[model samples]
Target: MKNMSLVIGLIAGMLFGGGLAYSGMADPARVRGFLDIFGHWDPTLAFVMFGALLPMAGAWQIQKLMKRPFADVQFSLPDTKKIDRKLVIGAILFGAGWGISGLCPGPGFAGIALNPAPALTFVAALLLGMVAHKFST
Candidate 1:
């Protein structure tokens, strides 16, 4: 069971990384272009976002019918529905970082394979931020 879980995780990660690469999301310049709404704004990433929603919507529907996940005892879904200051603040920080660096957690990690220099720098900063948050909270 553990081995199967590991295999599934590996495959999923590979697929996710491949998708990011194929969709040009792994490129910081491309992401920045998409984020830029006024100057030379690229609308290509919108398709990627819409494409992602389709699979996720289906997954949520499937999850509703399943008692338990195939590789897990429980669904391990987020139970929180309340929005608070922390959530709002975190979202602001996330948006700021994404705008500044054109890299979020997933792309930051995936970017390493495409361009290690900036990606490594982004990953290092990301890790530092995580550690700081852990200590502060």
Candidate 2:
């Protein structure tokens, strides 16, 4: 059962990676172009985001209907309703990084298959950031 679960996860990851690649999300230039609102802006990423949201909104509705997920593990949903200082700060940091590098976590991971050096560097920095968060918290 564990192996089957792993296989399913692998397949899902592959599909996600492929989607990122095909949608041009994995390309830093495309991502930067989308982020560049003032100069040489690209609106294509908006479609990719909309395409992603459809499935996610459906899943959210399905999750609300389900008493328990198909998985045996307990549901661990976010309960926060208020935006506080930490949330704002985190958002600022994340946005700044994304604006600067044009590589968020998903794209960074998917990029490993396309280009190893920069992707690995990004992953290392990401891991370090996680560790820093762990220590700070």
Candidate 3:
């Protein structure tokens, strides 16, 4: 069962990385273009976002009907509902980082294979940020 889970995870990761690469999202320049609303804005990322949301919306609906996930004993969902200062600050920070680097966690990881140097730098900074957050909390 553990091996099966590992296989499934590997396949999913590969698919996700492939999707990012194929969609051109793995490129920071492409992502920055999407965020460049004032000049040479790329609408491709919007389509990608919508495409991702469609399947996820359906999955959420499907999850509501399921007693438990097929691979898990129980559904592991976010329990937080409150919007506090920490949440707001974290969101602002996340947006700032994404805008500046044009690479969030998902794409950052995927970029490691596509473009190693920049991705490694981003990942290292991301890890440092995570560690800082852990210690601060």
Candidate 4:
């Protein structure tokens, strides 16, 4: 079971990496270009979002149709659907980080995992930020 899980994870990672490469999303330069709204205002990232979201929505719908829960484990989704204060604040923070850095957590780590210098620095800083948050809390 463990080996199967490792294999599945590896396969998933490879496909995800290939998708990033195909979409030109693994490059920080392209991400930066997308962030430069005042200068070039590239819509490439918007297309990327649409491309990613379409398949994701389909997968969610398919999963919903399944009678048996995932891996026979109880299906647990989010408890709250309300747009509360924390949700708003978290959204604002997420937007600000993406706006400033042009890379969210997944792509940021993917970039670093693929061996980019800028990605390494950003990921290191991100880890430090996480540690700081942990200690402060």
Which candidate wins on TM-score?
A: 1
Q: What residue runs in model 1 are displaced by over 4 Å at the alpha carbon?
A: none
State in Å the error of residue 84, model 2: 1.0
Error (Å) of candidate 2 at residue 119 is 1.2
Question: Residues 32-122, candidate 4, lDDT per residue (tens digit)?
Answer: 7888878976778779888889889997898789874434345557887899986798689777876677677767878876758867777
* Candidate 4 wrong stretches, greater than 4 Å: 1-6, 69-72, 113-115, 132-137
lDDT values, one for every candidate: 0.92, 0.88, 0.92, 0.76
Q: Is candidate 3 or candidate 4 better by TM-score?
A: 3
Better of 1 and 3 by TM-score: 1
Q: What is candidate 2's TM-score against the reference?
A: 0.91
User: Which ranking of candidates, highest TM-score first?
Assistant: 1, 3, 2, 4
lDDT by residue for model 3 (36-112), tens = 99999999999999999988999999999999877767888999899999999999999899999999998999988
Q: Worst ten-residue run, lDDT, model 3? A: 1-10
- Model 3 pairs in collision: none
lDDT of 1: 0.92
lDDT of 2 by residue, 1-137 (tens): 55766876789899999999988899888989999899999999999998889899999999999886565355569887899999999999988888888899999998889988888898898899999999998
Clashes of 4: 0
Name the better of 1 and 2 by lDDT.
Answer: 1
